[model samples]
Target: MADLSTLARPYARAAFDYANENGAVDEWENFLFIAGAIVNDKAFRTWLENPAVTAEHKSAALVDLYDSQVAGDNDSAFKQLLGENKGSRYGNSISYPKVSPALNNFIKQLAEQERLALLPEVYEHYRHHKAVSLKQLDAYVTSAYPLTDDQRQMIQTRLAASLNASVVIHESVDPSLLAGATIKVGDKIIDDSMRGKLQQLKTQLTA
Candidate 1:
């Protein structure tokens, strides 16, 4: 089978193009993010994988889930059904104001194709597309400790200048690094950590 990312690319691109054209990139991003999270849930995954569950049921369940989360007082029948079944396996939590028709159609298409499991990959690719379109870059920063606000701002400033684009930093801690930080922008890594330096020295000695 092809890789999940490979399979998901077209869907992501299609969704991104649609969102961009409609000037709803952020809205679509939020929708996909939440959808991806829902699909990634253990219970939801089990439900989706169940052979007995019809595709229609799965699709309806998901749509209902989203609706319940986002629907208002002027609730649809589906929302009412979800309310009645509130104690069912899928517990309700946070919700938005509405689910757009575009999102509904997108979810329906994924359901029809039995490709809902690819949502996470689709979301990742969509994010990449969004970043490129917005002239923004996502930087992953790993350090031995949490980055202070000042440090984060400094890194973002430098990265923005270097990449010639808006930079968003996501910080992570890796205590094994001993000290310092590593910044990953796309395929490139700026490894300034002590552990990285040690590895480079070891590689040189071995060479």
Candidate 2:
């Protein structure tokens, strides 16, 4: 099977192009960022994978989520159905007051094809596309735990200082790293995690 990123690229590009044509690239980026973060939750993934939830329901759930946040619909029925805002924890989101028809279809297609799980990958690809178009570099940060605002800023600042173009930090968590973090900027990767060091040591010993 193709890797998740490979499978997600076309979808990301389609969405990006659609957004660009409609003068909504930034809006799409913001939406994807929040959607990607929401899909990153383990609990939500488990729920989304449930066989009981239909494809339409899957798409509807996401649309309802955005609508509620954008419209301030305190009485959204789907919120109760989705679980106490399974996505409410994420902040700094750009709310969408009106979801475009193309955007709605995009989510629906992803759901119908059981590709919603690829959201994070799709978002990553979308970010790459957007950054390239805007002449910005993207830095990916993976850590054992979430970074505090100061930590994030420090990393962003340090990376920005090292790079020629403006850099944006995109973060994710992977507890299996055991400790510390890994940073990737374009082709360069810095593996500063305990797990990475252990693997390096093992490789040297085997050699």
Predicted structure with the largest lDDT when compared to the true one? 1
Name the Cα RMSD for model 1: 7.0
- The whole-model lDDT of each prediction reads 0.81, 0.80
Q: Each model's number of backbone clashes? A: 0, 0
TM-score of each: 0.80, 0.61
Instruction: Return the number of clashes found in candidate 1.
Output: 0
What are the per-residue Cα lDDT tens digits for candidate 2 across 137-189? 87899999999999999888888777756777778999999998999987999
Against the true structure, candidate 2 reaches a TM-score of: 0.61
The RMSD of every model to the true structure, in order and in angstroms, is 7.0, 7.0
Clashes of 2: 0
Per-residue lDDT tens digits for candidate 1, residues 38-91, read: 888899998888888877787777767666654655444443434443333322
Where is model 2 poorest over a 10-residue stretch in terms of lDDT? 78-87
The residue pairs in collision within model 2 are: none
